[model samples]
Target: MEFRVLGAVEATADGAPVDLGSRKQRLVLAVLLLDAGRPVSRDRLVDLLWPADPPASARGTVQALVSRIRAVFRAAGGPELVTEGPGY
Candidate 1:
């Protein structure tokens, strides 16, 4: 599987295009790809998604979005990705 983040957030599996879902979902995927091999805390994702004023459920939303992204990757034959941990 490969990802294209230069123009639009896109992924391909064996030369077939993978649907990245909504804009926000694509953004989340982009962040994960941009920071591949590094631990991207949930808080950091929430901040990047809603820097001005995050809703009370910002973290949860990020989790859901990430989950959806994982599903897409899984369907694309990609390995398990996007692990969760802790941060201050």
Candidate 2:
């Protein structure tokens, strides 16, 4: 799988485009990709996802979003989403 973050944040598998879901989902993916092999803490994700004011359930929301992203990539036979410690 190849990911393009240069413009519009796109993902391609086997030469075909992959649907990355909503804007926030794409944002999450972008954050992960930017970090690449590094781990991004849940707190950091919350800050990035909701810069203005994060809700009480921000952590849970991030988890849910990560789950959805993992499922999408898994179904596409793409890269594995690894969870290490408190981050994804």
Candidate 3:
């Protein structure tokens, strides 16, 4: 799988475009990509996403979004793109 983030956040497989879902999902993916091989904590994601005001369920929301992204990558034949440890 190939990812493009220069302008639009995009992912492609075998020259075919992959649907990355909502704007929030794209944003999450962008952050992870920008971080590359580093782990991004849930707190960091919540901060990056909400900044001023994060909801009580921000962490759960982040997990859901990340799970969806993982499904997308899995369908695209991506090689274990996002892994969970201390973070994603």
Winner by TM-score: 2
- Compared with the true structure, all predictions reach lDDT values of 0.84, 0.92, 0.90
- lDDT of candidate 2 over 12-77, digit per residue (tens): 889999999988889999999999999989899999999999999999989988998998899789
Give all TM-scores, in the order shown. 0.91, 0.95, 0.93
Per-residue lDDT of 22 in model 1: 91
- How well does model 2 score by local distance difference test? 0.92
List, residue by residue over 1-88, the lDDT tens digit for candidate 3: 9999999999999999999999989999999999988998888989999999999999999999999998998999875755567589
Evaluate residue 57 in candidate 2 and report its C-alpha lDDT on the 0 to 100 scale.
97
Better of 2 and 3 by lDDT: 2
Q: In model 1, what are the clashing residue pairs, if there are any? A: none
Q: For residues 1-88, write the lDDT of model 1, one tens digit per residue.
A: 9889999988889999999899989988888788888888888989999999999999989888988888887888975774756521
lDDT of 2 at 24: 85
| Superposition TM-score, candidate 1 onto the true structure | 0.91
Count of clashing residue pairs in every prediction? 0, 0, 0
